[model samples]
Target: MSEERETPERRRERLRQEELKRNPAGSIHGGGLPDLVGGMGWKFTGILILLLIVGFLIYSLFFR
Candidate 1:
């Protein structure tokens, strides 16, 4: 009997496929975070980041 080790790319592809089968919505192409922020445009992302920073500052100053 002969055993063949899978390549890195093949292993990643297999893992992605299995994840897709188990959780269709959670599987990400190319094995990274989804491009939701990229698709949202720079202006929107900047605004979101600014809001998060402001919110954190406010919470730290007033709530904590």
Candidate 2:
């Protein structure tokens, strides 16, 4: 039917609109910083922090 046919761009826009309706905050603001932090979980975040600390210690000992 005519209603079922959509150009690819129009279909993508339609899907984007539906996503906005479902997650207005994320759709509008690119999910924000909290979304990124929450998605990483405490374990991964801790590991990242540990690696940064180790890297900083190595840099200070060797380069400075």
Candidate 3:
């Protein structure tokens, strides 16, 4: 490596480029569904919904 140190702007640019390389052009974040899938994925979401539905049904049957 060269003895010359990188400036803040240059280091920031290099990190930005690396981040772009890691993510695709259409990568999105922070919406409800996007956050859901990003964290636990669609399969987990489906399972969770299924359990909630089953729990609700059992609660209604016995308590209501």
Candidate 4:
């Protein structure tokens, strides 16, 4: 029996097709934006505190 060898392009295309099947929209690159505003209690509170600190700094610089 004779074996058939696949070309480099064909092998690459096959791998691309398999990857597309596994992940239709490709892979996510990094940790996405956190849901600080709408997440659980501590997360929301932490974000609020950070915003308050920033606001206080701005107020001190411009208003006071």
Best by lDDT: 2
lDDT of 4 by residue, 12-59 (tens): 557666876898665466323332332345666788889999999999
How displaced is residue 20 in candidate 3, in Å? 18
Superposed model 2: Cα runs more than 4 Å off:
1-33
Cα lDDT tens digits for candidate 3, 1-64: 3426886545655665577678746345424554455456568889998999999999999997
Of models 1 and 4, which has the larger TM-score?
1
Overall local distance difference test of candidate 2 = 0.72
Backbone collisions counted per model: 0, 0, 0, 0
Candidate 1: C-alpha lDDT: 0.67
In candidate 2, the residue pairs with backbone N, CA or C atoms under 3 Å apart (3 or more residues apart, or in different chains) clash, namely: none
List per-prediction Cα lDDT, in the order shown.
0.67, 0.72, 0.66, 0.62
lDDT of 1 by residue, 3-50 (tens): 257755456556667877999766445435334563465698889989
Q: Candidate 3 overall Cα lDDT vs. reference?
A: 0.66
Local lDDT at 17 for model 2: 70
Candidate 4 residue 60 C-alpha distance from true site, Å: 0.3
Better-scoring candidate (TM-score), 3 or 4: 3
Residue pairs in collision within model 1: none
TM-score against native, each model? 0.47, 0.46, 0.43, 0.36
Q: Per-residue alpha-carbon lDDT of model 2 for 1-64, expressed as tens digits?
A: 2447886545655676788799787656485654555557679888988998999999999997
Which has the better TM-score: candidate 2, or candidate 3? Answer: 2
